[model samples]
Target: MSTPVGGDETQAPQSRFAGITAALRYPDIRTLFISTFANQFGQGTSHVIIGWLVLDMTGSALLVGAAFAVRSAPNLIVGLAAGPITDRYDRRILMKIAVIGLMLTALTLSGLVYFDVITISILLCGVFFLGAFQAMYMTARQAYVYDIVGANRAISGLALIGLAQRISQLIGALLAGTTILHIGGSGPFLAMAIGYLIGLTCIFMLVEVGDSAPDRQETIVENLINYFKALRSNRLLLSLMISTAGAEILGFSHAVILPILALQVLDVGPEGLGLLTASRFVGATVGIAGLAIAGDVKRPGALLLTTMFFFGISQIVLGYAQTFWVAVTLVAIVNIMATMSDVLHQSLLQLSVSNEQRGRAMGSWIIGIGTAPIGQSEVGLLAGATDSKTALLINGASLAILALIMAALLPKLRKL
Candidate 1:
């Protein structure tokens, strides 16, 4: 069960939970956690607002897909760059700067809306900018966590963050729908801007941790080349990335399709969409809670593979659902599996990688996570051509097949 990160054998379990609880109590972790929670809540709210705004303005599925593409394309382009930058700078400062950038972007978008000058192109550009900052901020934040809780307790720390994020999404999605109905799109943007500012302030107030030593001094190009070399050399890491990427492609590909599913397949309105979204968040919250309470389980690797299998099956069930409630339940189950898989995969990554290579390893991890949007766009195009349900079914079946293939090919993945 133990892989020798830090604590002694007799007290490892108690120490792990104690570290997690202490980290939660620390001003640094508390401020960081709260700031992240607020930011994530705003992110969930913006997801609904942006899609609705795009669809309302253009009334075209293609434009909505484009908007989603704009939001995610930065991950494909700048995700690698983010890791080096995160390692080079003080992460707390980097986080504060990113939050400021986000706040400004949100305020700018809101101003455009207020002036009735916001175009689809402008909105897309704003989304791209927002996503770029988010990528940088997340890279820095993930790296910073080791400073707060030490590498030994990173998984438990991550689990707590996941729990907070899920709760935020569960509340934020429903609130966004109602806020949009009552106060309009501009209202959500204003709220998002305020959230970013609040997060920034919280970040500023936290006790500063001195920077970790830079991973290695290489030119940006050399750093990138070294990263690829590392990735290529580590077959276990590469396989894990590939497995996760496949699952993400299948699961996240349906994000845009969900609204379509609500309207077309379920014949329920935006309320149904909100409920379905909330149900997934609820499930994730439950899964995170379970992980938190389990302390330190040894089977994260096998657990990840099993979770992916169930996640794929849930997607298939969701694709075949004939009613709103049924689809909601299926999506919730899917979220539960997906959440568990994510936590386990991340834990494995943190446990297995060397400290010096953490930034690049995490960057590579982001690359895999980021590429799912490409699949999302592909799914959107397919759904536009055919039915959303059909697209979901095809992607889900593909995921299940990929999971089985991975299990056969990489036996090490079954043990963490």
Candidate 2:
């Protein structure tokens, strides 16, 4: 059931925490928030663990990217279908299925590595399934948060979700890194599997869907066909998707080369790489917390464009950092904008469409971010052929230029 909205909300006692307090008042949102923490914790650790594993087993940057590429490839393939699917079914059921998939995959990967039977082929297959489930779960979760919170509280709901994700990801990254250093085994993957179990338990507590249920009765193909038809006239959404895809393909792909940067460039090994990963969440925490406190933004498009521009520039600067601390600081700053871009994209996309269409809008977001595999492959191969520094310079510049071009050419987007 949807939370009843009251006109009195405008007259409520206010504080910096007002937005957060109101959203958490719902039991469903609270449990879902906890699950978010668990889910992202697994995700944070998986990125570092899987990337490092592929690197260790193959000793090739291109292979590492290829592994990550296989992992994210599902977004492009399954994301479109996932949108209408989530809207058509009970999202709670979909969430459970995705979490279960995560649990089994993580457990299998852990056991394979523990028994010393793991190979590059097995690892690749493992990450591919992990990525597919993650794509479905993320798209559903994005729409479900709105289902629980209603439109009035969407900004805060999404901001709070971002907070949970960033903090847990920070802990996950640090723990995964430390686990590698001390246990030096499958402990990280085991921990990841357990995290999904915890998340699944939380899903059991969810109640009912909001009043704004499915918008129309249509088959999956008919629903998608209409959405695509809508996109022809929805310039703002098209622009949003293009910009989101650009950021994923360029700015966020910096992660694909972190292993190379840690070992060859910074010489800090796994521990330092963990710090680099943790710093991203720290930066994201700042951005998300600020958004939660700031509450609803009247004009988010301008801010979104600004964040994308800086996000791109920071990546370019990161390529030139020599010291470990300097690189860490740069990574943190890069993600501050990165997460802001993320929050803006999800919030704006959900708000842009009707209640019933929100899932498909988010599905478009999934499709846009699916470009990550392309970026990952490019960075990994370029680093192997030339250097991590050069790859960063190129991708970073392209992203920054794209942001500027969007701001200039798509004036409607900026005004949205």
Global lDDT of each candidate: 0.73, 0.85
Give the range where candidate 1 is weakest over 10 consecutive residues by summed lDDT. Answer: 1-10
Residue 25 displacement in candidate 1 (angstroms): 4.3
RMSD of 1: 3.6
Best TM-score goes to which candidate?
A: 2
Output the number of the lDDT-best candidate.
2
Cα lDDT of model 2 by residue, 26-111, tens digit: 77878888999987788889878987788788889999889888998999877888988987888899999999999999999899
What lDDT does model 1 reach? 0.73
Cα displacement (angstroms), candidate 1, residue 166, comes to 2.1
Please write out the lDDT profile of model 1 over residues 238-328, one tens digit for every residue. 7776776787778766667766776556766656666777777888888877786675677777778778887777787787888788888
Screening candidate 2 with a backbone cut-off below 3 angstroms (N, C-alpha, C), the clashing residue pairs are: none
